[model samples]
Target chain A: MRKRWVIGILAALMVLLSFKKERLFTEPSGWPEAVYDFKRNPPDPAKIEIGRLLFYDPVLSRDSTISCGSCHLQYTAFAHVDHRLSHGISDRIGTRNAPALVNLAWARDFMWDGAVNHLDVQALAPIANPDEMDESIAHVVAKLQKTERYPALFYAAYGDSAIKTEYVLKSLSQFMLTFVSANSRYDRVKKGLDTFTAKEAKGYALFRTHCSSCHTEPLFTNQRYEYNGLPIDDSLQDWGRMRITRRSADSLRFKVPTLRNIEFSYPYMHDGRFKSLHQVLNHYASGIQQAPALPPSLQKGIPLSGSDKAELVAFLLTLTDREFLYNNAFSFRGR
Target chain B: MRFFLLYLLFSGVIAARCQEVNVRVTASFSGKPLLLESFYQLPGGDSIAFDGVRFYISDIALYLGDKRVYTEKDSYHLVDVSDEVTTHFRVSATQHFDKIVFHLGIDSATSTSGALGGDLDPGKGMFWTWQSGYINCKIEGRSNRCPTRHHDFSLHLGGYSGADLAIQEIALPVSPGDIVINLPLDKFLAAIDLRRQHTVMSPGPGAVALSKTLAALFEVSR
Candidate 1:
């Protein structure tokens, strides 16, 4: 009886310790409420870990040659910088650049075209894209079920060894929800913990004047599709949001991406046309393409001199959160 | 012991009052039952064979006159012609209903509400991966009139937004008994020209138009 009591108490203590060590999703101070409905699929440490594993696993691809981490590297703030268009399995080139994955909990829609309405189903796009993973969600679930490690992991996360599409998606969402990057120099300055340099301060002022309307603060995006006045690419002819909405007025409009990690997430824009921030500024300054439906702010274009462009670049660099970039928790872990 | 006996008696009475009505969906070519991969004569003198025919029926509610009498909880059914088991489902009704109302496709809200399970699950091949909406109805076949490669045609109807919303609510009056819903394939093929509009895999005007036609094709029988 005494031995049984000791074992039961030890088991209870282990449960308590596990609960204490479980990682949680935290909303950064002064940030708005997350758009994600956590009540539907609440966060669990085991589920998040399962998602992290699945994110790094190449089994999601047809040939197991590529993973989400392949395009979205942790060091680059989860955005691929090596290619203009995202290269998929078998080196197949996609149409648009892979946008950086940061503060996704606040995002209303996913993808450059806003094709995916919810984040839970966002991974479906790349997984089933012919140029990307070239695998279906059904096939991925089947593959995971056959894996010895996945059954155990899924059992721990979802309390069932049988893996389904819902569990796979919800777990991935849980892991991504933990990807909170609110420790950047700019964020610190906002919190009164640090101060921005003179150039950065000047750039911030300039950003508020010209760019902050679309790239709003606190989240760095207003989350609306706007026509940025880029002349249509002759070869691609991608209509952006118009393809999804099927409206003439929505033609050439794309979702405004978050400018949180602008330093590392290079090769910018929906198609990654501009290689540098200077080129982007130059586009705004004089290269705004003439269009009938262009927003008033870009109609005349922001007349920014070379010095102002330099200052903007300096301020953009302050948005980089090195802690998020180098965070080991998000990095690849071997099973 | 007396209270338990009384409770059991009350539950039995309640269970007896709730009648289980089986809903059987059948795809018919003209007046005859349709079979998959079997060639059938079209009105245009063209031969056609259905490779697949699947659709979603959701929000099933029974109505007495204009008022809803009973609504099935989580009422989403995937009726796949090839899989006869999926074509039949049971609903419990406490009272009699003259009209059966249901949406021919998933609603806009449910389509946008992240990963769903069961018949609405993405694994069922009903949900579109490239886009976020569910493929409300899928009809893939080969018609001799089709000009495509291998004389094939695929129509996946779905879109839950603005001008492209494809879901159609269908209400049919019926007698008080098990319901048998028939989708006349002849009428559907008669409405569309195979050569000009064979492939419609995306959510657009084609999908919405097809959905509208398909919605009107549902007929209820005792």
Candidate 2:
């Protein structure tokens, strides 16, 4: 009887030890707490791997020709490069440019229009969109269930071969929550390890004076929609936040994009009309269209000299974190 | 031996008497019972046919006078006129309660929490893809009075924010036996001008107004 008791206690200890794995995500120093409810879907190595596979697989699309990685490439900080607009399955063009995927665990809302509220459900938009994947969650689960590789993967992640939508979404969130970009030059300077050059420092001062109110620090975004005074696109007639809120006051307001990897994730703004930092600076300096919904700070437009523009661009480039762009862990592994 | 047998018999009687009760919901277009794809005449002399009618009922609580006795956990239910399997729910309570209260839509807690399973799942087509809230009520049908395509009207009502909150609490007097809740479609149509505002796909002022009308349409028969 004592031997049996000792064996039972040892087995229980082993079970407890198995559950106490090292933390997969660590909060960046001096940053706000993550908005994602990690308690509901705790991270596991197996689940994150499964989510990474799902992210790379084209089976998510209707024609099995487009995967999330097709639009979001890691080298460009997980944003689509070159194309002003996103290209989807069957070579179809999407309305908006794909935003960079970094530090998403801190975001309460996703998309330029703030359409998706949670990270777990953000994948659904791309999957169901006709121009994008156009595949249903139920169909995706069914397809995965038939695959020999996925059943084993699902069992390892969730302890069951039953591949449900909830598990799929949770796993995807687990993978995405690991995308923390806090290693930029700006971050290193703040941590007292590096000092900015004269031009970068001057640009940082200009940014604090002009752009810090909307694109606030350490996350580099206030996560609110603002009208930066871009004139309406005649063809698309995109009304930005008004499409979601339906309020005239919210017209032309778009969720401010993070500048963490601005060097690589170019073709800026909601429509990606500006291809270069020079064009974006010129828009702020002289091209702000007068509108009722325009932000008060940009009402008279940002006054910047030629050198000021160059300095601002120099500072913006310091935000590019090469560690994140070249991280091999986020890359696709062969089957 | 005799005493043990008597005790067992007494406990059995008590168990039977204190068993849980089921509340079955049935939809109707006025006084008549409603069936899927059933045609009914409006008071305005226009004919209408309902292809689907479903809504979420959640956060149920049993009140004994001023004191609360029972509250159900994970109590979200999607009641559909088309699905007989989800039309009924069991309410278990040891004590007597004079009234029961419930919300028309999911509470703010569940609405804010990301991706849930079963009835609250997005697979049920009750969730908004762009926004992050549950559709409180979905009423889809074809009416000759409607001027839109296929003469169809679809109202999906739910909101979580202030001034746009569509979830309403309703209290109904009840007894311990089986209960039947009636959702009167005719009264709901009469309350709103479907021609002027037939379709509401998202949460806003329009959805909140229709949800108020829907909240008043339920009558419990004990």
- lDDT by residue (tens digit), candidate 2, A1-335: 99999999999997765455325787887899889988898878898898899989988888889988998999998898998889997888988989999999899888888878788889888988888898887788888899889999998888889888888888888888888888999999999999999999999999999999998998889999999989988987989988877889989999988899999998898888999999999999999999998888999999999999999999999999999888877888876
Question: Per the 3 Å backbone cut-off, how many clashing residue pairs does candidate 1 have?
Answer: 0
**Candidate 2, residue B193: CA error in Å?**
2.5
List pairs with backbone clashes in candidate 2: none
Model 1, position A156: C-alpha lDDT score: 83
TM-score of each: 0.93, 0.92
In angstroms, how far off is B18's CA in candidate 2? Answer: 4.0
Error of 1 at A116 (Å): 0.5
- lDDT, candidate 1, B16-82, per-residue tens: 7788998999999978888999999887588999999999999999998999989989989999987
The positional error of residue B42 in candidate 1, measured at the CA in angstroms, is: 1.2
lDDT of 1 by residue, A1-335 (tens): 99999999999998876555334777887889899988788788888889999999999999999999999998988989868899999999999999999998898899998999999999999999999999999999999999889999888878889898999999899889888898899999998999999999999999999999999988899999999989999889999998888789999999999999889998899999999999999999999997766889889999899899999999999999999999888989787
lDDT of candidate 2 at residue A209, scale 0 to 100? 98
